[model samples]
Target: MKLLLTSGGVTNPTIRAALTDLLGKPIEECHALCVPTAQWGHPMCGPASVRGLLAAEPSFRHLTGLGWASLGALELTALPSIGRERWEPWVRGADVLLVDGGDATYLGHWLRKSGLADLFPSLPDTVWVGVSAGSMVMTPRIGDLFVEWAGAPDDRTLGVVEFSIFPHLDAFPTNTLEAAERWAADIGGPAYAIDEQTAIRVVDGHAEVVSEGRWFQLTR
Candidate 1:
């Protein structure tokens, strides 16, 4: 499996370069399916959220401006809502699955309810790019220690990755290195703390860190 789990979406040159490298192609030729299910977990999943996402164009413009293609938003909240027949092909055809972040529990619930988790293993060639909660849901669990930040507290996750990730370190309110360290100390297995400019890239079970900011890992 190939996964780029990030604290924030692509926002800096290092990350952009890492993504381009992961794809083994110029950013211009990539086709991404933006999964925004996480936004729904928040209180602003309506027009305001849409506008906010659109406003982030400047940050992701490296790809958008480079002739990269996108297929609107993929709402994975439910099977019928996303039209499995149509969206499934779109997801399979895309080179990258770009997932936004919000409540990890909510996103994981919908992903499983929609049967998307079952499909992940089939998309071996597709790069799974996750931002924050999007990244958290792929782990075995989202620790309760982070309840103050994640809003929801469901420990069950996709388990796509064996470890847990603590994102937005020092970026969001109440998020700090000390808090991340404490959370990791209590975790039963491996855990990592990633800042906005950092990402954890895992390929074929091997993990590597790509960052322009702070990040640390703890292992049991």
Candidate 2:
């Protein structure tokens, strides 16, 4: 599996280029499916905000300019009427799975409940691009880093990757790099703290940090 986990979406040439490289094709030829389930997981955030966020999303504009075909949030898990067979093709056929950030616990629940977790390993050609909570959903768990960012920690994640990610480091109202580092210190396994300018790239089973911004990893 190929994963480009970012605090923010594709916001720079370095990260953009990394995504294009991972796609192994021109951006124009790619078909991307955006999943905004995480944002909806928040109690205060509504669908209007989610729509507004996606409508003017920098990453959406960035990719569209680069020639990508954006499928916008499918909302399959959100809508109960849609069966797996109906949306499974869309998930399986997409060139990229663009996961938007919001509440990690909320998103994690849907991923597991909706059976998306089982689909990750089968998506050999799909590049999973996670933004903030989207990135965190792939790990073993999301601990206390977010604090008041959202609901409680589900801890149980998709497990597509091993390390937990703390995104938006040093950003307002969220985690600062120092606090994140301290949180990582308590984590028993590998974890990372990254800002909007940073990303964690994972190919197969190996992971590496790619950044134009500041980042660090905590290891046992």
lDDT per model vs. reference: 0.75, 0.76
Runs in model 1 deviating more than 4 A are 44-46, 54-56, 59-67, 81-83, 145-153
For residue 115, model 1's alpha carbon misses the true position, in angstroms, by 1.5
TM-score for predicted model 1 compared with the true structure: 0.87
User: 1-220, model 2: which lDDT tens digit per residue?
Assistant: 6999998778788998899899998777888777878877765567775775557555345332345666655663654467778788878788987787777777878887787777777887789888888888888877754533445554556677888887888776657777777777766678888888888889988898888988887664
- Over 1-220, each residue of candidate 1 has an lDDT whose tens digit, in order, gives 4798998777688888878888888766778767777767766355565455544455444322334655455678656674678668877778887777777888888888787777888877788788888899899877775433344545667888889998988887778888877777777788988888899888888888899998888664
Error of 1 at 90 (Å): 1.0
Q: Give the TM-scores of the predictions, in the order they appear.
A: 0.87, 0.88
Candidate 2, which ten residues in sequence have the lowest lDDT sum?
A: 57-66
